[model samples]
Target: MTELLWYGLIINERTVVNMKKKYFLLALLLLVLVFSLTGCVPGDGANNEEHLAGFFWGIWHGWIAPISLIIGIFKDNIRIYEINNIGWWYDLGFYIAVISGFGGLSLSRRRKK
Candidate 1:
């Protein structure tokens, strides 16, 4: 009876750990999906025209610059100026926030487990 009880306890502990890992993976996947879909920020401005340019431009400047820079480095012929633009810092902040928010949630969930 004692051996059976010990085995049951061990199985329960393993099950708990497996559940936590599954939840962590799910959360990470959801985070990546949200970031990719939204371009890592809110409000792309679908209806508003005057502000739409600023919104879309901000998204491109923020997210695209790093990607463009990496590609330019690989290509070795692309100019940095072609990818450069104003208001990039704003987009950087948005990306950081999105990544950090998801990261924080993952950390907290791990801690709880």
Candidate 2:
């Protein structure tokens, strides 16, 4: 009858709404998990006392910064930047790479006029 059809439609709408809510919660949970597990931190020590990291190492580190950050979070030996470096040159290269690598991501987006 008409009443039964209305009831079925209402139930279907409720089910759809519930499904949306579930997906939203799942996405939120995944975001929280990802953010909680990844981050950057400075590191310093005599781990590489014999051979200090130079400009090239800085560039390499900057290029792999994201991965290093994640690994650094879980491992004590891994760090985003090297403390025992050649100072200015190392810093310059690190900054250059970090800036360019991250800035490049913005270029991939198409602008709407």
Candidate 3:
């Protein structure tokens, strides 16, 4: 659809409008994906720093787990989970975020509403 528009091939106004809407939706979705997958702020290699990435950070990282995982494959520095977390609470937040981000979405889509 977009290819046709790019090549100056779309002749009908209706087709162009429809394609524009589709492209807009596609762009919006891409934007959401990019933002959702945003990783944490990089830290220095210092060993004695306080780990602020607790529950909130865990939720954010977990929500973007899928994207982070993909990026992790290419980059070594980028990690899905914090190396030094506070404890089980961090794990709790990550699991909650994962379930909400993935499973919750699936559940929502299943309803007609």
Candidates arranged by lDDT, highest first:
2, 3, 1
Candidate 1: C-alpha RMSD after superposition = 9.9
Q: Write one digit per residue (lDDT tens) for candidate 2, span 1-113.
A: 12225545644566667889999999999898665534332354532667677787677678767877777778887788888787899898898889889997897889999
**Candidates 2 and 3: which is better by lDDT?**
2
Model 1 misplaced stretches (Cα beyond 4 Å): 1-11, 40-113
lDDT per model, in order? 0.48, 0.72, 0.69
Residue-pair clashes per prediction, in order, are 0, 0, 0
Indicate which candidate wins on lDDT.
Answer: 2
lDDT, candidate 3, residue 109?
73
Runs of candidate 2 with Cα error greater than 4 angstroms are: 1-47
Better of 1 and 3 by lDDT: 3
* Weakest 10 consecutive residues of candidate 2 by summed lDDT: 38-47
1 versus 2: better TM-score goes to? 2
lDDT of candidate 3 at residue 61, scale 0 to 100: 70
Evaluate residue 106 in candidate 2 and report its C-alpha lDDT on the 0 to 100 scale: 95
True-structure RMSD, every candidate = 9.9, 8.0, 6.5
**How does residue 111 of candidate 2 score in lDDT?**
100
Off by over 4 Å in 3: 1-11, 21-25, 28-32, 39-48, 105-113
